[model samples]
Target: MNQLLNLRAQVVKTLLSVQQGQSLSTILHQQLDQIAPKDRALFHELVLGTLRQWFSLKALTLPLLSKPLDNPTVESCLYVGLYQILCTRIAPHAAISETVTATKQLGFPALSGVVNAILRRATRETEQFQQTLNQTHGLPSWLYKRLKKDWPEQLESLCQALKQSAAITLRVNQRKIGRDAYLTKLEDTDVQAQACPYADAGVFLKQSVQIPELVGFSQGWFSVQDQHAQLSASLLPNLDGKTVIDACAAPGGKTAHLLEKFKPSLLIALDQDEKRLNRVTENLQRLDLNSDHVQIMAADATTWQATRMVDCIVLDAPCSAIGVLRRHPDIRLLRQASDIAETVALQKQILQNMWQQLKVGGTLLYITCSILKAENEQQMIEFFAEHPEAQEEKIIADWGIPQTHGRQLLPLDQQGDGFYYCRIKKIA
Candidate 1:
């Protein structure tokens, strides 16, 4: 019992630190792998569930706090505690006891009484107190305001989708095995999956599985990618021998997919972060994609000089990542309204600089994992105004909402992450 309390306290402490400006993903990466395998899933569940429902919990607990807690960590613990009792399958009595016992583990032994009192009171008046709670659309006020102001029509549905967890989707390497053959393998392994209609290689899993444990994971028969993201590689023009660059490619999903589908004479996987670039290399090696045919560069595409312009460039430009809030809960907490403007500026810089690297009349696929208009449709509109030589090519896909110059895939349950893609042809 005490052991469980200790683990719960540690998880709460890490989450609290993450709430107070630390990266949840970074902290989880360092800690989750070290935890006992049996506890890892629950640990992830508690952390993710707490963050997923944080807004509702905050509203429920506001009136319970008579005075401000001395430490933010303790305050965060109460949030997760509420989540355990109200959301998880954990028994209420055990949750209350463990949470109260955890005050000492959080280095605040004196706050045991405070934690117990608040949690017990919350438990007794749970339904009534929650009814009075105000919602922040499960987002920071500033961001909620922006999303509402920009997309009033879709704000409700969009926020709802942002609160849900994403499903695991895979893209098969048809070069190694046919989709039907892969499905047969999955059936033999007792794993259920369905073919995704949007992308030829995409597969939707009925249940999530670990990456390394997947049947053909190491064999390079398939790769993990969102069904929506699979569209980026699918939407591209034929690259039978043309040069292609996955600008901002890290972890190399699209790069590998492009290689698996098309015979790009030369593919350049470029990223600004060398640490992240190594991940791209590792992914390529694991997928058994031709490392020799691809040039992995650690230089920023915005400034890197190319010997010659490439025939095609897939600029997965960095943005606010607002569309993928559910996948990365920390994004909702860490990203601010001001960050969008900064990202927009950086995106503009990357787009303009990389446009110089595309051969005349070549295809430049501009993409972002952002739902905001400023970062998607509006950005493309602004880009067109500046570069008359750049002509918007129709994204000839049945998926995603067609925008003035691009296709916007607002995240839905199965549609995958909210992504924007605009195919541009350099007419000049």
Candidate 2:
């Protein structure tokens, strides 16, 4: 096998699966081992870039097509080639030749001509072709229409932001190293980083690196979390000696933060997936924050609750996850307009079920990685109507747009991932 060509071939297969409705994260996680460690980064870049800009490439290639190709898998292979040409820094001659060679490796020797012709024409014309010529902003019409309706003024900027990669932000575990100390350490190692504007303990890495290789990673000096998400645990107030539950907590970034920052009488971190719950345990153990007081449970909060009402509760309610599109580009392809309504219904059910567990004076912080009104504000509206006892507590923050019932951080927010937070206090 041509090793370099083989890497591109693997990327083509991954792209095909993503185009077939499989998520890029799942497919890449399962297939990463098959790729040589040296090539994994490029493999990820090619596959993710292709998916993120699928339509942008379509705008460039559609006219160049001799005709619509029959097999989408073959078309996917061509997309990997074209993505390398138009989007990546790969030299055009090498990108085109290597990708065409992979067609035979992918068992489509006959389609090599079709792939070759389109990519060659792209290199010749793409320079001037992209000059006011690329109109499609790489969004499916269904998503574009919905986003336009929801955020008429911001949709264009949001779409542009979605095509870019997200910055890797870390929440420094003050237990191991303070944020300022970590900033100095990053400098010593030539890793470019700076303080996060919002979260005091947050560090924004100017250039991303493999998480494990960062100094003190083994000692749990920090956790890879979005700067916006780091605020979730901070929104809860005065947990000293109070019972708290982080419902839907998994891979527990917020759970770890809550434990690290406050002395809770009992902190029960619950998530439905047993496998994912283990991830929460791993994170806690690595941070040296896990103890008897912090119990990791694999139970669905919507269906399960403790005998006693907790003083503080975190419902990081699952929703469409439409907000984190920059980090999870596959969402653009996999998500449908209908998924929003389905997710809204489930979020409402979870909110209703979990509200019963909050003490009269207790606080419940509702969060989602979705900016959709259906999942954010409108859900708050419906929840308020059904539960007269629930009052929207003000989120007195300097960041996020203040919504009628909550604050939402759009994706383009300088130092944040798209997030929505609604703090409520039970006042009946």
Candidate 3:
């Protein structure tokens, strides 16, 4: 019983940390080690599931409270209890008991009764609670309004997609193994997966599994990448023996992909966050892609100058990350309306900087895990006006919606997260 309470207490603490402005990923990375391996799954499910449906859970629980709870931790406890009872297959009695006990374990023994009463009331009024949740979109008002304005026709479906969990997608390393061969290996192991329809090397796992435990993980047979993200390598013109730049390329999924597909004469991966650069190096090395041909550097994309003009540049610029909310639900809580303008300014500066480093007729693929117009289509429109030498190289692809500037893949249930891609050429 104590162990269960400790585990539930940890979930509440993690959620409170997110509510306190810490990222869910960062917190999980820092704290997962302390949790028992068997309990980590439940911990992650509780934390992520609660955040995914945070707004709706809030709506379901708030009306039960006569007055708002003064303590944020206690409030987070209520959310955890409400989520499990309403969302999971866990029995209502067990969910409520564990949660109330966990609240006491969190040093709120006096409020344990309050937590129990609220959850029991919620279970008793399941239909009404579900109605409240159904009516809610699980997004903040500002974001909800923005999405509604941006995608009026698809708003309902888009919100529903965002609330669900994302599937684990992988990009098979063609250099080491063929996609069909890898699928055969997965089948041999009873791992259920299917080839992505559009991405030649993409595969969607039927369920999430520890990445390192996958069949070819240690041998570098594959790299976990989104089907949408895999398109970046294909979007660019062939770069065999050509120079390339992957700007803002920490945790180098795209960088490695570029190297794997094109075998570029030189590929420089640049990112400003020095700490994150380590991840890029680790991933490259694990994939056995670390070579003299690839250079990983910690540098600001907006200010760094390339030694020479390159044949291709992939600016995976930073943005609100609004499109990947399913993978990182905490984004909805961390991002603000004001942050969008700041991000746009940064993206514009980096685009202009990268443009200066591209050779004439060189291809620069602009990508972002964002669906906002201001950061995507509108941004491209402004860029076209600023650089007369720049020309739009329309991406003729079957996936994603063709926008005024590029293509957009809206988040869909059991499909890719929202991503936007635009290809431009230095026509001067």
RMSD (Å) per prediction: 2.2, 1.8, 1.6
- For each candidate, what TM-score against the reference? 0.95, 0.96, 0.97
TM-score of 2: 0.96
RMSD (Cα, Å) of model 2: 1.8
lDDT of 3 by residue, 270-321 (tens): 9988988998888888888746898889998999998898999999999999
Highest lDDT: give the candidate number.
3
Ordering by lDDT:
3, 2, 1
Residue lDDT tens for model 1, 1-428: 33455667867867777778787866788777666778888889888877877776776677677877767778777877787866667887888888877777767878878878877876797676445432336788888888888778888887767877998888999888998899889999989899988988988899878878879988888888888888887778899799988899987889989888888889988998888888888877777877777999889776887888899999999998888888888777788778988999999999999898889989999999888989999999999999999999897777888888899988867659989999999999
> In TM-score terms, which candidate is top?
3
- Tens-place lDDT per residue, model 2, 1-428, is 43445777888877778878998766678778788788789888887888888877666667767687778767887878878877789999999888887887888899898999888887887776555234567787888887898888898788887777888999999978889999999999999999999998999999869889999998989999999999987788889899998899997989999878988989998889998898898998899985779888888766886888889889999887878887888888789888888889888878877889888998999999997888998899888888888888899989988988999999884577789999999998
Each model's number of backbone clashes?
0, 0, 0
In model 1, where do residues sit more than 4 Å from their true spots? 1-5, 125-136
Rank the models by TM-score, top first. Answer: 3, 2, 1
Model 3: lDDT of residue 104: 88
lDDT of each: 0.83, 0.85, 0.89
